[model samples]
Target: MEPLYQYAWLIPVFPLAGAMLVGLGLISFNRATNRLRQLLAVFIVSWLGASMVFSFAILWSQFHGHEPYQRTLEWAAAGNFHLMMGYTIDHLTALMLVVVTTVAFLVMIYTDGYMAHDPGYVRFYAYLSLFSSSMLGLVVSANLLQVYIFWELVGMCSYLLIGFWYDRKAAADACQKAFVTNRVGDFGLLLGMLGLYWATGTFDFDVMGANLETFVESGYLGAGMAAVFAVLVFLGPVAKSAQFPLHVWLPDAMEGPTPISALIHAATMVAAGVFLIARMYPVFEGIPVAMTVIAWTGAFTAFLGATIAITQNDIKKGLAYSTMSQLGYMVMAMGIGAYGAGLFHLMTHAYFKAMLFLCSGSVIHGMEAVVGHDPILAQDMRLMGGLRKFMPITSLTFLIGTLAICGIPPFAGFWSKDEILGSTFEVSPILWGIGWLTAGMTAFYMFRMYFSTFEGEFRGNEME
Candidate 1:
């Protein structure tokens, strides 16, 4: 039997193919029957299911001592300058593959039930498939150029999906906000990539790692120039991960559908930023000043997000800020040089945060059924009360997510979060103090949202 890594190319292909087919169906069959729609949903989901299985199998192979895999085909060349299309799968890519494919597969399944009555059913599926494919491509990219190509594609997919409900003015504006804000970061990313190439003469990460120190020692790459390059690259993650000033766009992104919120805020887009910093660890490690900047940025963002979440009344916006806070924790972990702990939190956060958003989606869905089409009234936690009787499973699952995010014992989040806190304490007790306070606030606001929505009497006005 062939090792699963050899078939890794199929992982991204399956989703891209599903997207093309569904997109063609949308154009060809405008008035698709219920049966036809169901079939399309099943077909696209099965494709992702296949990708998920393969992703897991590949991850399994990696754990069992499989070597990293790479396949490169030259795309362009001018003298010594060459561009290649390829993928590299090692520990990081393998982990991301499983995370992206698994969460995407589950989200699509949930969306089938959630969007059953919506007019954009087929289009939504197509966008999701495209989104998954772009992220998959990004994780497996072999070089900075490949990563950048897929990076922009991922951003474009986000823009499309965040505005999926284009008729809603809020959704339209939110997508634009996301797009423009990210462009600022992307320009920084492009400049950084060019600087790296100028210093090292290649975009391949492994090559850059091997040659960076030699270049710096030989006067080809100055220490100051290297630090500048690293910081410019850092801006990409600062914005993409919703760090500080760039974070304004994410809360507004709640205007989009909830699944997109879960995908972007939880696992894919925001996660990409931290993942980039992790991938480029060697360069940043050399610059103590750059590392300090990252650590403080993450520390401040964590405190800010938790404090803001405490003030939110809109359920989704509350969760959005919570995501921002949680992401800050992960980035702080990266900044503190707790690489393993940072990634541990990323994986744990992916599962629980995605669950929290989905649980919130279930609540909003139920509210719409009872309260009619009042988006504002439906999302207001002030109006939501005594919902557990109507949604036992969602409430229970949501509580589990609440406890997990709050870092309670025996939960996945506790172990990961504890690791980060321990690492933070060793680095700076001041930052650790902030992290500890943020943890307390996290518990308070999460339970506050929970009690407001799931306890006491139902306060919502019912539809006639």
Candidate 2:
């Protein structure tokens, strides 16, 4: 059973290998080899899906009800700092691993069908595999440094995937904007890492947690320093999670393919910020002012995102704002010392949100085929209506997603959001009130986008 941890690293390794294979295939093969490219793409995604199932089974058995699983592999050793690549699979990371990989697999499947005629099919699958592998590595990382490495890798893949249609100026611009904005957050995260190394003499999370009290009590780590470091560290979460002021890039990110949107917005990239907060829970808890700041920032972002979403006419942009709002809720939960609850929301959000994006993709594909347009116009809800009459399957799935995101009872979203609200109430009544208000606003905007997109008369004439 202990050896199972060694196999854990293989999960990410397989996808990385798949990515390399597909990438090389794309470069070597020409347009004449379209069939080969498609076959390779399918193989890469299939391998990743298989690896995820294997990893999940092992993780479930090892950490289902037992202690945290830690596996360390010696990497580079230097004076005063011994860097070892390792992973900590506790309840949190275990759950994240499952969510990321599963959502990624589903998105890839949806992509296969949606992008069947795309010229860059092989390139698309390669990027998808790379993104999944990076996200998996980040989730299971035991140290901040390792997490940072994979974090940047995920960002790079996001840039590539979002700008996949590089011929389109908007897609190129959106990718650049997202890349540059996230770099700002990454700078803050790097500073925090350096601060941690300076204070604790190590970058390992477990070591930092164990020695945090000693460092603080000895005055080596004061409240002011903690607060500053916490704020710097949280900058990454703010940008990555699409929190207020840094949230502009997310709505524009809809310029990418719908499948890419599902992968980035719903499953992996956006979740990285929440994961960071949970990873550093102990260190942040020791700084009261930092926690309060986190709580207020998250609450405000939630409200702001929900309000902005109401005004967005683009379907994907509306969902993008909704994602930011939901992520803010998770951040608030973490700030209020509800780590488990935040994680719960993250889990549920992954399922329903991915479903929503994929369903949107289906509708977009149908519209493209029906309208005989060179470029699809699915993003603009103003150009869409009566979709239920045209694509019944997609309509039903989209309704389920809408219901789930609205936090209606019996759906996954309701369970997670309620838990987050319950946790917020424990900390402050005012914060709880803000969260509830945001929830209601989320419901209103989501249904507005939904009804306007699918329930009204078709704004364009039917194809002859």
Candidate 3:
């Protein structure tokens, strides 16, 4: 009997259908009824839940057989060239599918209680479903072109979700900033893809992976030319993963809903870069100079994020910078040829980061209930303290997340980060030192944010 992996394409389809159903409410479906809204939520949850289950099945097959399952279909044809669309079910895709769907499902479940009173409740869930589909599509994509297509779709959904509260100017501006910033990376990606196609006449990842050396040598390309193409491709990951100058958009992204922040921080948007680099590891492995650039870029970005995070008074923005720092760790691992370590960190970070962001949302929700949701005090850590007494469960979960990110022993971050640091030690002690120093700073800032938010006296206006 054939394995169930061949049906991997359906993973994204279910969420897409859920998004479509929720969207129909805008026209004639009369979604305002509480009973209908509850049913829609149930339907969306079932689809995402199914996707996660299917992902786990593929993972089981992968470990048992060590064989990737693939299914391809012709998307378009021109002359002798063919554009294909399909699914690739490998260990990486299987892991990513589970991570994306799992985070999305949890966030959706949490949103019901968190966003219950919002006027745009139905629209919120619709966008969440759309975001889930976009991310899963990217995960199962069989080719670079398909990845690019879904990459842009993920960006679009992020833009819509970030500016979800359109009446607020800050939300609107943050959305514009994020969209425009990503375009910088996308432009380079487009150029690199066009060059690759011009040189090789095919956009399929498997084909390109197998024939890259032959294709590059066919043009008799020099080191400089090869480096240029590699760097251009690297730009896409840098921007999406929030490395260095391209990383400024992520902190401002806190203007979005906290659940959306968790999605972006954990599995969907930012993880895209690290995942793509892992998928195309062969290309980078061939270029030594490109690898060096990636290592130093990650080092500097990690330190920069740690420093900024230490100074941030806004709880969500502090966590945002921490995510940037963690992503840098993943990128540095990839640069040093520790592909497994990079992916390991990505997986562990997904769990803890999602927990951290959700806990922050819970904190904000409780505070809003107490203070009546004032715009002036929203998400400001300066106005939040002694929350642990009021929200012990949220505080405990958030504390666990802080410990995990700090690389404390017996925690997920400790395991993954140790691998990255150990991998760096073999390559360059200087880089290892940088990674170590950043780890210390990560612990400091994470605790600083936690204490400032949950300890001491109430920081909010006492009269309120």
Span of 10 residues, lowest total lDDT, candidate 2 = 370-379
Best by lDDT: 1
Q: Give candidate 3 misplaced runs (Cα > 4 Å).
A: 1-3, 30-35, 215-219, 462-464
- CA lDDT, candidate 2, residue 198: 81
Lowest-lDDT window of 10 residues in candidate 1? 26-35
What is the TM-score of candidate 3?
A: 0.96
Query: How does each model score on lDDT?
Result: 0.89, 0.84, 0.87
Which residue pairs in candidate 2 have backbone atoms (N, alpha carbon, C) closer than 3 angstroms, thus clashing?
none
lDDT of 3 by residue, 39-117 (tens): 7788888989999888788777777876777788999998998988888888889788888888889989998887787
Point out the higher-scoring one by lDDT: 1 or 3: 1
| Candidate 2 lDDT over residue span 87-126, tens digit each | 7777777788788888898888888788888888877888
Query: What's the C-alpha lDDT at position 418 in model 1?
Result: 97
TM-score sort, best first? 1, 3, 2
The best candidate in terms of TM-score: 1
Predicted candidate 1 versus true structure: per-residue lDDT over 1-464, tens digit per residue: 25566668888899999999888867777776334888888989999899999988888888988888898999999998889888888899889999999888888998988888888887888899999999898898889888889889989999999899899998899999999999998899899989988888888887876677788788877878887887888888888899988898899889888888888887789888988888888777767778888888898999999999999999999999999999899888988899999899999999999999999999999888777777787898988899999999999999999999999999999999999999999999999999999999999999999999999899886323
- Give candidate 2's error at residue 88 in angstroms: 2.6
